[model samples]
Target: MYFVKKSIVIVIGSILISLGINLFLVPYKVLDGGIIGIGLILNYLWGLKAGLTIIVLSIPIFIIAWVSYRDYFYNSLHGMIISSLFIDFLKTNDSLFLINPVYSSILGGVLVGSGIGLMLRFRTSTGGTDLIAQFLCDKTGINVGILIFFIDSFVILLGGILLSTDTLFLSVITIMFVALTTSLFTRNVVQA
Candidate 1:
């Protein structure tokens, strides 16, 4: 029963993430943190696909997890692969959401946050920011969420400096939404 429930959650979570990427973030040109954010920034600079970049970037993070944290690697591998595939596949459907640029940031934030929360609830992660967060937590005994925020915050700030003001503001809003939605979704999840 637990396995079934977890599988369902992963599916739904991945859908939310893909929706956030294709419908909200990608269309509006908003950025988040982690590998995805970097991918978006690169896309802005180099005209690359953010989804494909995320998948490729995740390879190194996965390699690190596999070598340094076998348990985390085992747990997050499926989610990382599925979410990456879904994000890339859903690009063709970008017009479905029909949201404005600002709304896109908010919606994307909520979706991404909730997705990550659900994955974390199941003891899984998408293995971009989470991998780094886990490494920090393991090494420093600080909360993973806080560490994630700190790291992402730096990226967002850099994005602000490098990009437009709108992108910077949207990134902040998106991160806030991600944090809120993740907390709301995983409020009752137990950590093992």
Candidate 2:
């Protein structure tokens, strides 16, 4: 039962993440933090696959997780791989589902946030910078959400510097949604 429940949650969360990326964030060339943000920036610069980029970029973070928080590493590794693969494989096939930037941002936030929350509730994560945030939270006594916000903001800034102003603006919006949604989703877990 536990396995089934966890799998279902992972599936739903992965789908929401993919939708958030494909339907809204990627279309606008926005960036989020962690491996996802790196993937977006790379995608913008070299027209690479975001999912592949995410997987490739996650290596170092995963190594960090392995060294610092083995339990977190165990829980999140699968979520990260599945989510990245689905986001890359599913979203790349089409571009017919675009929506308004504001609405997309909101929806993306809600879905991604809820998905992340669910995963966190199960003692797992989306597995990118999340592990780093957890590591920082454990070591520094800072809130994970705050750590995530700071890290993501840096990534957004990087996007701004490397890309056009329009991409920078979009990246800001994307980071906003990611921050809002992630916070909302993790409210219960973080509180606990």
Candidate 3:
């Protein structure tokens, strides 16, 4: 029962993440942080596949997880792979909702954040920088959400520098929503 529940959560979470990216973020070229942000950057710059890029970029992070946190490696590897596959398979050219970019960004962030948060609650995650954040959380006694926020903000800054002023502004908003939603979801749960 526990394994089934975890699998369901992972699938739902992966779907939400993929939908948010394809339906909202990709349309406006807005970004979420961490590996997703890097994936988006590469997608924008070179038409690379974001899912594939995420997998490729995650290699070193997974190695770290394998070495230091064996449980995390097992917990998150499937979520990460599933989410990446979902992302590559589901493609959308433009915003399906026809909302303005600001609203679009907010919704996108919410969905993505919710997905990430849901899996996290189950002790499974879409490993990327998330793996690093978890490791740090275990080491420093700091809240994982705050660590995610800082890492996300750094990525947003990178996106801003590499992309456009508009992208910078929108990405900042996106990451804020992502952080808030993620924190809310994880508020009462003891980190796993």
> Which candidate ranks first by lDDT, i.e. highest?
3
Candidate ordering by TM-score (highest first):
3, 2, 1
Candidate 2 segments exceeding 4 Å error: 190-192
What does candidate 3's lDDT look like per residue over 48-141, in tens digits? 9999999999999999889988999999999999999999999777557878999889998899989988998898899998778877877887
> Which residue pairs collide in model 2, if any?
none
Error (Å) of candidate 2 at residue 54 is 1.2
Instruction: Kindly indicate the candidate among 2 and 3 with the higher lDDT.
Output: 3
TM-score of each: 0.87, 0.89, 0.97
lDDT of 2 by residue, 1-192 (tens): 998898888888888888877777777776666678888789879989888888888888889778877888888889988888888877764556677766666666566666766777777777888767767766886766667778888887888899877767776666666667776766656432
For residues 48-151, what per-residue lDDT tens digits would candidate 1 score against the true structure? 87777888988888888888888899888888778877877777633777767788899999888888888887888888887788667668766566666677
Give all candidates' CA lDDT scores.
Answer: 0.79, 0.76, 0.89
Give per-residue lDDT, candidate 3, residue 76: 93
